[model samples]
Target: MEWHNWSGSVSAQPRTIARPRNESELRAAILATPRVRVRGAGHSFMPLCETDGTLIDMSDYDAPIEIAADRASAWVPAGWSLARLTETLWKEGVSLINQGDVNPQSLAGATATGTHGTGKDLGSLSTQVIAFELMLADGSLVVCDAEHHPDLFQAQRLSLGLFGVATRIRINVLPAYYLEERVEARPLGEMAERWQELAAATRHFEFFVFPYADTVIFKSLHPIAGEDEMPHSTDIDERPFRVACELGRKANFLIPPLQRLMMRLSSKPSRRVGPAWQIFPGERTIRFEEMEYELPRADGIPTLLEAIGYIRRKKLPVAFPFEFRLVAGDDIWMSPFNRGVGSSISFHQYARMPWRALFAEIEPVLRGANGRPHWAKRHTLGPDQVHALYPKTGDFLKVRAEVDPAGKFVNADLARLFGIERK
Candidate 1:
């Protein structure tokens, strides 16, 4: 069966794709093959799910959400999409601690890959995990938390789909709340100097800047006082942006002007009020290939500006605006933000166009700032760089060896990335 990601950038023709409706079936599917990989919503840009062997499709799995007695957290089904999970949680009067710009990714996929949203003090979804129920390659299920199997739990927080297949995840939650999304135009220079202040002042703050533009779109999501009549929002129509991307794909020369023009047209301030789950993500229809870097808090803006400066000076025609956000640090062994706070910079290009050279040139700027790539995103990091950037690689590899020494969970991409033999 041919399987591809949402953006159609990565494709795989697996020999078998099994949709397991329950844990027993899932185990059977896993044990039936020498090699296996889970297929989430396929939001990852890299070939994390590319497998020539069995591919376990978890979309059919539907375990009940067991809310903790105190309601501070819940045991959520690992395969549920963020869209499904967050909406279901909302019905239960709870919501995820935070979510990224889109919600179609699976709960396990998002947490495993260190996916995150923007907040000065809030860590990524991986940090929200208090425990995990993982099925080992031998089909045995083990539950690990901070107090039980802590080493395994630490590595599982951002396991990158290596340690095992997460069957259930215990994550932190917040009582249902409302958020106000405010987007306005601001000068890049002013923002560069004070973005940290902006981040500290809001519940979530992020900004988008075109490589050649001097202004940025500042978006902040903050809690609203009460649930009242939601204010009307003049959301910028996305159709024009799609058209611009198509134009840029055909004639790269127009990308610079198109971006600046769109920035001008998109300058109008907009406001909307909705549930936290609804407000956290926006509609993302335009497809683009992305490479994201997680840098130290102090280096994020500097790295972004340097890359943008290079883009302008080189007259590189990048289609999408750069997204910059802040994420708090965590202790997850494989997480990019493990040691300290992070500044996340996402570089995107219309997938229809050439990107090898573009990202090739820009990635060094990020790397030079001591930035680490999100495991799921596109990057040229080899095994050496992986070990150098993530000092915990040795520890994680040790855990993987202990749990699945036969390498049942190792796919081609992962085997090469982690220097593990494909068994």
Candidate 2:
């Protein structure tokens, strides 16, 4: 909602949008509407938050966070954006153990959808969660964690916004540490050969491979020992070829063919270094829809290469680069990396192109390799398939039924997806 979802690909229409200032208001809204769903930053490419009944905007629920006296943890309002939360917590000398690239997402929204970043040593953001306060549809509040209401805690961590509205979350905090990032253009061959070692070497690791280009950008990050130390050796914009590539991307639609042309013409190695956030937040000005999957780390490289080969052979206009990342698994029920280390492959095509065909071409390859789709990203899998994938699906539904038996918090789509019918 803050940025109109920038993606602008949503198709859902809400009967009304409600902004609640507190738990009582949210409970009242839930009870009042026969059907409802919560909307976050609207970053989800799919219509998970879609509802004809009502939409709850938790944006107004932002409240100041409090750090624990031990400095080991802190609590934040569910609706707070990652950007504001990080900036606020930085002043208190603490930071999230890991953060996704873009920080514009709300806390509950990001966690609910299993949004993540890459790090073998570090896990996805939700894995750092210590506890949360959930406002149930029946106007009751429940606190959950690994010890208290363990089932609810696990399921709600990445509940796809189906369980209830989370009002606050408490997460383990790490001492704020500066990060030094290194980036280099490497051959795809190197990625295949050293993938395992590379994943193990850094605090965070990711790569980008442009279609029709022989080169791949390998990026790594590590914690810096001291403050005030510069993260990278040189300015990121020094590479004229990379700069040209970035500029040309802005006009990709008018010059879609130019991308392949540029890749062929300016084929050269490039490098850059900076802080973790700076390096991670690279410009993705090109417009495209993404489908990502998280798989066990051991199967990651093989699955990705096989998918890439399929794309190349099929000659899909997949002009946008592919993204590969690693993250430690969490207990979040619907998270792709829920139970183990995960390797993610995100592919995209220009927005104007027919997404249905492209996605159809790619889905089989991903599914063949045991990949689980990112809940917020584009994927056709509904509740039946979702239950088959997640181990705790049944338990989550049982609890959800008890908490919102009237289906007050469920949208029609969600009801069908979860196979829940109001009695």
Model 2 over residues 1-423: C-alpha lDDT tens digits? 222354677766667778989767887787776778888877788777877777888878745688899998898888887877777777778877788877778888888888888888677777788898988877788999989988888878777777788889998888876776666777788988898888788888998776556667777877775455654433233244444445544554423355445444544544444344444444444456888888888888898888878766777655467889988876666677766888888887656556668788889888888889887888878777888898778888887887777777676666777777854
| TM-scores of the candidates in the order shown | 0.97, 0.88
Scored by lDDT, model 2 comes in at: 0.74
- Name the 10 consecutive residues with the lowest summed lDDT in model 1: 226-235
State the lDDT of candidate 1 residue by residue for 1-423, as single tens digits.
Answer: 799998898999888999989889988999888889998988899999998889887867867799998899999999999988999999999988888988889999999899999998899999898999989999999999999998899898998888788888999998988888889999999999999788888999999999878999999999886566374433457899999989988898888788889988988997888888778887787788899999999988888889988998898878888899999998788889988988999999887877777899899888889999999999988899999988888999999999998999998899889888875
Give the C-alpha miss distance for residue 60 in model 2, angstroms.
2.1
The number of clashing residue pairs in model 2 is 0
Using lDDT, give the best candidate's number. 1
